[model samples]
Target: MEAAISTLITEFKKYAGKDGSSSTLSKDEFQSLVSSQLSHFVKNASDPGTIDQLMGSLDENNDGELTFTEFWQLIGKVACQQGCFSQ
Candidate 1:
């Protein structure tokens, strides 16, 4: 679990830094991250509209960017949807 969390943090930082904003993920950064790293999880990764919609949904404060917390929430949602349960 620790290693998985660490990896998630590393990926987030890597993507966020793409746009020179090591604090948040811009639209392009988010798209690149999802398409390149989360292609297996996110559907239609190559669709611009899908990426835009996802980015909009994840932007809680309407800041047009995704924070680490927001990104984690998205992961949780995808996990639940994929039935990655331990029951």
Candidate 2:
């Protein structure tokens, strides 16, 4: 579990471009990162919509963006679900 968490953090850094030390991301940056890294999962979601829906659902503020915490919460929700990526 530790290794998995570490790998997850590393991947998030790769996407977030902050070495996993920060907890904020511009809305566009977060959307781009998630769409690319999580393509398989997002594509397989039950709704089958693009990453836009995922971002919109989590953006909360409707500012067309997401903070790091929001991004993590979205990813964590998917990761915590069984077979989310398998679709």
After superposition on all C-alphas, the RMSD of every candidate to the true structure, in Å, is 2.2, 5.3
Clashing pairs in 1: none
Candidate 2, residue 67: how far the Cα is off, in Å: 2.7
What is the alpha-carbon lDDT of model 2 when measured against the actual structure? 0.63
lDDT of 1 at 10: 98
Tens-place lDDT digits, model 1, residues 45-65: 979999999988889999888
Report clash pairs, candidate 2: none
Full-model lDDT, candidate 1:
0.90
| Clash count, one per candidate | 0, 0
The digit string of per-residue lDDT tens for model 2 on 1-87 reads 899778767766666564333445554556566666666666644333555677777887776656656776876677766455542
State each model's CA lDDT, in order. 0.90, 0.63
TM for every model, in the order presented, reads 0.91, 0.57
Candidate whose TM-score is highest: 1
